[model samples]
Target chain A: MNNALPRWVDYGLMPLISVIVAFVISGLVVLFVGESPVQAALLMAKGAFGSGYNIGFTLFYATTFIFTGLAVAVAFHAGLFNIGGEGQAYVGGLGVALVCLSLDSVFPWWITFPFAIIAGALFGALWAFIPAILQAKRGSHIVITTIMFNFIASALMVYLLAGPLQKSANLGPRSRDFAEGGQIPKLGGLFRPLGIDMGASPLNVSFALALIMALVVWIIIWRTRFGYEMRTLGISPRAARYAGMSEVRLVVLAMMLSGALAGMMALNPVMGDQARLQLDFVEGAGFVGIAVALMGRSHPAGIVPAAILFGGLYQGGSELAFDMPNITRDMIVLIQGLVILFAGAMGSLFTPAIVRLLTGVGVMPK
Target chain B: METILQLLDLTVRSAVPLLLACLAGLYSERSGIVDIGLEGKMLGGAFAAAAAAAVTGSVWLGLLAGIFVSVLLALVHGFASITNKGNQIVSGVAINFIAAGAAALLGNAWFNQGGRTPQLQSEQRFNPIELPLAETLSSVPVLGPTYQQLISGHNLIAYFAFAMVPITWWVLFRTRFGLRLRAVGENPAAVDTAGISVSWARYRAVICCGILCGIAGAYLSIGVSAGFVKDMTAGRGFIALAALIFAKWRPVSAMWACLLFGFLGAIEIRYQGVALPVLGVVPVQLMQALPYILTVVLLAGFIGKAIPPRAGGVPYTKER
Candidate 1:
């Protein structure tokens, strides 16, 4: 809304300050937990990037966030707040599990992978389809319906895992382990030419898929007519309606696309990492996507870095927790909360100050 | 008859938290502040109350501590929405995450019991208090046991929750402050024209919302449960929001709506393992998902349309 500020100041400077504020507060929390903040920071850095193994883990986590972040961004572009990413991703995992369980013994990985993608996207889109239709047709708020769907999806997942897909009564409520067909090959072997030992990291081909999807999303949202209309819908629904754009179609399509992206997030965790569907595999990644998309300004260029940063936080926070028992991974969660607070909620707090500073510096003529 | 009476009692018990949270939402939403962070605030209050009660061994202190923490969170929401004119939903989401993370981090660090406070003794909890003559009149025909079972034996907070319904109705319908508060939600410009500070009125409403939510959280921990469990408020906050919507944001209607949902919850707990004639056994997940599903259906206008307050979720600006 403030066109006076340059793009760099708006996107780059704003998020930078928010991240800094989040970090400083997080440091205070670490100190409160009876640990040295400086040492915790050092341990976190070393833990996130110390070895190729850690990098792989970081990338693995990043891949999950990328898909979910894009999903939220797509919905954001359509004036829809899709809080059902958790549910869509869960249902998408269900689709992947169905494909893996059915075809694992019959086909190899390559044959099953494409089908899994289709199934994942289809199932995820299907899960999102209901809330989308409800919002479009009934004028029901997407936020409430989508959030309710998350709980419903969770319940559905529990029922499926325990009732039908469960392997046996002896084990926990999880699907059978996928065979060679379902398990995507990790990218560790690809790093061997650089003389780096990947060391049992779970980074897989999904990382490339995630990157490609990011580019695809950029094209879909920016370069396509459908994307333009969705953005128009978001910018001002009244104007879009005046222009004779079918509000129902745009809302439904945008939500389905968003849900598909969220559903595809299951690929990174299920097929790529665990190779089986389990309870709560989404693990609040959908919520994390909200923070990511907001901080990224719903752009792929911004989302990738944000995703990686959070991934590092997840990986490094674990390392910190291992070393300092009092400081758990929740420290990163606290930082995430602060980031969402500063970057998303109170995101415009620094804008007025930045505008004044920029004008004072003669960067912009008042 | 006895089982029916017990179910009604359980219904009242479960409905108390929902009722308190619904009233909380009523105050905030009626003031035109969309509080998606009700869940988070209740969660934070639950942790604060349990931890305080555990430390001080006084349930009163726990209730105060819970209210204090919730009010702080409500202020955060108010600051974002009113002062900064930031996105209300985003602020609420941030509040939820922050409360959730901070509660866990602090609980784990302070208690060292894996994100759970130490179990409270009777002295540290809000034990149920029997009304006078409850035992003496137990032998009276059909009315005696009903009065004793349903009306007489809930804890102090439970009585306070019921008492709040009439008080809230009185305040909202009869008081001058309540008129201004409702006026702000409906037409902030009109209120602004009257030379009243919109933000100040909203801040007060948000604070009131916070107090009610804090009481709800304290009730969940000290009133019903022994101690605080992580995520103890569960989805009660959201369900309360749903009840607010279903009740059309009115005070007395909210009570009826919450009691209905509470009855459903009581039925869910009672008939969880019982197999019906057609369906083999009702799944636990089905029961857990019912409230959310019903809210969605209500939202879809299958039963009735839920029209939110005018100007709700929008930050007030003079130009706008």
Candidate 2:
């Protein structure tokens, strides 16, 4: 029970359990529709990673998730739920798009790219700053505020994309494609010599950028003084204040950083991947960030693998229904849901035993 | 004058589902567990009601099925947060995600319209009530036409939603059960001292919350519209949660807040294509976001502070 290996096993158990649960649930679904669950699962696996293109595409999707998961994880560690990551990411995408479209004629790709990223980050930070300021000053719960902000941002994006920023060639609610100079150069062709063709895959320099950012985030959280203050504030605001930390500034900073990381998710997709903005384009990554946060347990190091797992599901699930008509991509979402449920119900697994054993030991006095 | 009356009628119909959902949140949060998953439960109930109605061709049976399904979800939520001592917010999120995917999966499989149900005929749907006596009252004066058209023209659920305000007030303030429920939320240890079961009170409150959410969903799918669509509830549930906070978790106040949000929704949807010179073609999307923006602002400032029950989310473990 006290072994480190067993502790690691416990940590690894939930993801494996969730996949099994998902398979069982999907099996039931297949049974209802008169299909073999194993065949459906096999089809799903093949659809996900059958080709080099599939692997590239899956990694591409994971790259965006990495940014979002890190965003949620960072904010969660600060004891704040950053559900507004969706809205922030949307705004961040807009910021990056606007910068790319406007500056393509004047600046080179190298200069414009970093500027776009900074612009995205600032916009995201400002978006998050609203809720942080309100929570710190007026004691408004962040949960409600962040959720409300999400709606506002979604609406704002729809309006912008449908009207002011609508692409001239496109008749829908989407922005114009970025200038040629602004597009991320493909590394897939470079990898083609090794039998990898990354055509139509959104992954590029952004995936590496995301991993590096994750490492930087881990350092900031575990080593920096600001992170110490944020963690302390997360645990107990009163204690932090007594320890001479500014609670208001730390709270605002935490949210701003959270939003900034979220902004990078947009950067990964829009600049290094999609090169265009569409309505509901992020496809609820903001809300899904909550799951990633829970699954990762708010640890930056933990979030990398967690994000990749989700990324694989996204990659695999999309192709499931195509290969196997009975098993839909929705199974991925359901499995994610099951993982969240198991993770959330973690207390039920051991609370009774822990309490009884502790009470028996006289640790909890009668 | 007639235009104004029509708008008022629209407001009432639009507000009914939101009002009911807000009332549901009022019950759950007042008992001390944050019900962010109300959106999911409402959506689940809506899908269940629509599917049930489509299968059985009976509105009444569909409504019951909807409530039953929603209550089951709330039970799951209660079990996790109340019994397992898990984080209430996280558990609520889990319920929402599960409901979203599960309902969509089932809906797609059964209906084959990508999580949407087939529209029902007039006989299969809930019919709005028409009062013959209100015909004579339409010409009396300024109030007569308003009353006849706005108040008397809604379907049964609209009236039920309006009636629920006073009923909720009476149940929460007048009844002994309400007192014990509130007691359990505020201080479960004290309720335990008083020989009342905290767990039972909370469980019952959550069940009531589910029933109310079910009614809200039924109103959305059947009473307001003819069929269920993916995420048809949109963010109405969150607005309901906001209304709960705005009303300080008081049922009557929640009613007014819901009406306000419903009015905004009605205006946005009704006036989408109309070009106002002053507002410069107000996009439907911008108007759709008005309620959320308003909620954030109110929660941050004008509503002042609404405190939750101190022991709301904590699981009540009996000490032997």
Candidate 3:
């Protein structure tokens, strides 16, 4: 397969083509609703990238997706599908809330941030631990268990936020606002001095952290011996078993790593943007991670840009919602589904055609 | 006794969609194609049925619309996995998102009721059909009201759901197509060697799945509720998936499993705010989470094994 299509074509051109196809289909959907897709596209473009504020919002969303997309990518590399990122992110936010509620009054912002990171990751990993252990030791299909866990996570969050965590009896399922130290300053101030005015945007240092994690993830996945063993297991479980790789050890570690990255997504929302931890803040970003991971081919380098692209769609879709009374944010979700359909599921349809075209054009030997 | 009877009646209504979906899963998985998109198809079907009924003022048209849209989505899944040899799970996931997103988007766009269709009239929905002797028999002994409340007065779809259990069993075990379908799931190579088209059998099986899921969706909206609500399936498709696993993919056992889950749901509704002896006031979340938790426990083989078909989840590459 690799011999038929080069890595550049596989990673770059193929995904770009899939995205275009998805957008075209989405345009048809827009057309069905009696809206002009061309105008909608222009509105989306202006909405996503027309202003510094929009760019900041897009980056903020990308920062969250970067964590979740990497989470899915890590698990994918280990031959596991962790759809429970939603649950894990929710729990991770819970961990952040606990850290802030307990220590924010005493500690400074810098000190509180580190503990929140650890708490979030630890909690997220812990949420995924049961499903991983079940898959490794009990042969409970990881996909089903993770999905069940997602529902369970939603239930658990409702229980906690609506019952135990709700300090004010009159308020909705939400917690008390965090103190000053708990809420990190936006990157708007940091960017203004650099001539990039991120006007009143929620973008924070989490974007930088996401990039750093990407570098760290790249090193771990490609450079480490553990990565080699994990990839081997993913490629062929039989061969990995023959080589005496510990399925339990590798699976648990890989899932925990995946879970931790998902957990870190809370930093962008609960800590970075929202001053208070609330219900449904993760929204569907966890699911969007699946689309990002597939489109990116489970590579960090690909994932970063893919995350931003989805982030742009999300930011733009909200903007479109206000202008187009008929169109909604669900249109973006439709695009997400189309992307996954083209890039992940039916991607094989493109391979042979690409090979034939390349051969016919005399670009490659037959 | 009246409360108990009413609980039993509610169980039947609640179990119908789960039963439909569980049986739908049975056909696809037995044919060796994992159908994680059952929820999506059901959701899509529910919305389509409700919208169609709202517009046409006919329940049958709604059911047809539901089945048509579901089959269309199923064909898309078939094209992706069966034809293109792509990842079935990924395709199913994509289908789930697409159906859900499309249902909501189209609903809001068309009706403008925040993703809900108009309030359906009695003629546009499947109202309960009272039996011939239901009213007359209600004043008699124990068997009288029981027959009236428990056995009778359900919409036509509920009876159809129960009838499907035996029908599905017969189709999967007794018929020639069933033999070929089961064979394809178990060993497509053997089927191919025998000159039967593996793709054709799987495609037919997928269509059957689409029809059942379509009915399940219709049961949710027009049959049970007055109109469609966003996410009205409310994870029932996944619960049905759990029931399919709980029943070990057998049609008869699937019915019993759905009944059990439905009974639990009834109990949850009956005891929403009530207190129990040891547990105190049970949380609604706990009751809601129990099915998923039990499914995980069951899948771990703590109680018994739930092994899938031999070739399930694997794409059949002809040369291989």
Candidate 4:
């Protein structure tokens, strides 16, 4: 679909058109549900950004999305679809849980946070390693393996939560809450010294960490030698091989790094927000990352805003559901699905038209 | 002996949906359109069938409605991937998400049972058909019990599922349309040069896939269960895909693969808390995860290379 058009129009106008189309369709759906689309949209905006607390919550959700989005982007750069981010994040939660449970009472927050980070990365990487090895060595398709791993991870989480990790006295399928030392400091506390009040939202120091990770990903993907080799392989494996790059090594390395990023996503929910290990903590964020990656064009800079947009949707959709009687939670999911459909799948639906218009306007060479 | 018969019966019942879905995948993938939206189509069909049956009280109408909804979704996939040349997998994934959300929203609106339709009446459902002379055959020896247990009591659609295997095989291998379909999957350029429209063949194939997936969905709500539950297909569509791959995309092999997966599911349900010798008490979650783990193992080329259609995921562009 790439054509002789300005890069901004190619990346910006096309996606904007797709998003507008999606929202228009979603508005019709909302009308069918006997709700006012205008009201719903207004409420969503208010809920997502009106108050300090709402902004905090939105940013918190965005923090997790940033991690998972980068995870998907990293893999996309290597021509791999790492759909197993959900599973990787799940196992990564288990890592955080283990660190919090065993050492929270004994160690300080500074010490436990770093250890948990390493544990999360290792567990996520280990989860991804099997599929990576299979793809690299046995020629198994990465998409199917990663998808299967998601279900496997869900089942594994259910088992561990019920059998070994279940809190001793609690009957629910969740681990015991972490101690104070294991819990990350909330942003509300950080803002106390200033005149501004951030409110008691779950937005924590992890948000800053997420931003740092994004920068790191940008550097790794754009600046490093490994990044060049990965992009070369993604563009043409035959060319990479001709240049004496080891396809197997790069495939495994890329997947591991992707998995590690997905695993780091768990830190936000487990350590920052939930302060405990719970079943389905990853929810659908890992899958949502695919939409993020696609809409962002797998660029770090693009991914940050894409993640924030989806985070706003998540937060705002809940608010709409709360405010309206006819509009249910599923309706919000339906809208999100429509967004994903238009933005990711039917992305090229309007590109040719735009390209033609641009050419007719003498904006670019035909 | 009785337990074994019961197990076999349950396996057939469980395998029926998987068989239909696997064949559905086979048709689409053979025509070179990879369908990960089988789960979504099945879910949509199940909801449509159940809702229509509850409203109209006609099982046949329910079946038609289900097929209509599934085909509608398949058309969406076709438009995105075939007409627009978009990513097929992303389209399929989007379809799944849309179906999951739509089923929940519409089911709740229609039935008010939190995304579940009303329980279907017996006459409005596809009840098991007791074969003629089953009682007389019961008087016979070993073969009598086997026939009665295995084949006699399944719904009409289950029989259709079993019959589809040979039909699919015949259509794919012996018929002219089948040759063109297979040719398109392997090399659309060749098919195009030979004067067959690649997109038309793919659209027809996807529509056929939709009908099969519709049957699989209808069987779930009206035949096996009594109503539609939110996301009731429960990854069976995906497992059917695994079965399709496990069978190397052949019709007869797909049947065997579905049956194998069905047996594993039967074991999971029948022996939920049963203890075994070496492994001790097997966890239910382990049993639930077995099919997927096995799929991963199979996909790793442990058994053999599971080759897909040569041009399976690639969208056909005439200029390209």
How many residue pairs collide in each prediction?
Answer: 0, 0, 0, 0
Superposition TM-score, candidate 3 onto the true structure: 0.98
Q: What is the interface RMSD of candidate 3, in Å?
A: 0.8
lDDT of 3: 0.92
Global lDDT of each candidate = 0.91, 0.79, 0.92, 0.89
Q: Candidate 3: misplaced stretches above 4 Å?
A: none
Best-to-worst DockQ order? 3, 1, 4, 2
Q: Which lDDT tens digits does candidate 2 get at residues A1-366?
A: 213223443455544555465558657866786677777767666765778788787778777888888888888778887878998998888888888889876777788888887988888888999999999998888978988888888889988888899976446888777777577665577678998776767678778878888898888888999888889988887899899998889889989999988887887778776678777777877766776766676776667777877787788888877765545666666666666776655435543554566568876544
Record all residue pairs in model 3 with backbone atoms less than 3 Å apart, i.e. clashing. Answer: none
Query: DockQ, per-model, please?
Result: 0.81, 0.65, 0.85, 0.75
Interface RMSD of the candidates, in order:
0.9, 1.7, 0.8, 1.1
Expressed between 0 and 1, the share of native interface contacts present in candidate 1 is 0.78
Report the candidate with higher lDDT, 1 versus 4. 1
Model 3 agreement with the true structure over A144-234: per-residue lDDT tens digits = 9998999899889889988989988788999898898898878887767777777888999889989999998899899999998889889
Candidate 4 regions exceeding 4 Å error are A191-198
Regions of candidate 2 where Cα sits further than 4 Å from its true position: A1-6, A345-347, A350-366, B273-283, B317-320
* Whole-model lDDT, model 1: 0.91
Q: What pairs collide in candidate 2?
A: none
Number of the predicted model whose lDDT against the real structure is largest: 3
lDDT: worst 10-residue window of model 1 chain A: A325-334
What is the per-residue lDDT of model 4 for residues A30-111, given as tens digits with 9 covering 90 to 100? 8886778899999998988877788788888999999999999899899888989999999988988898899899988888
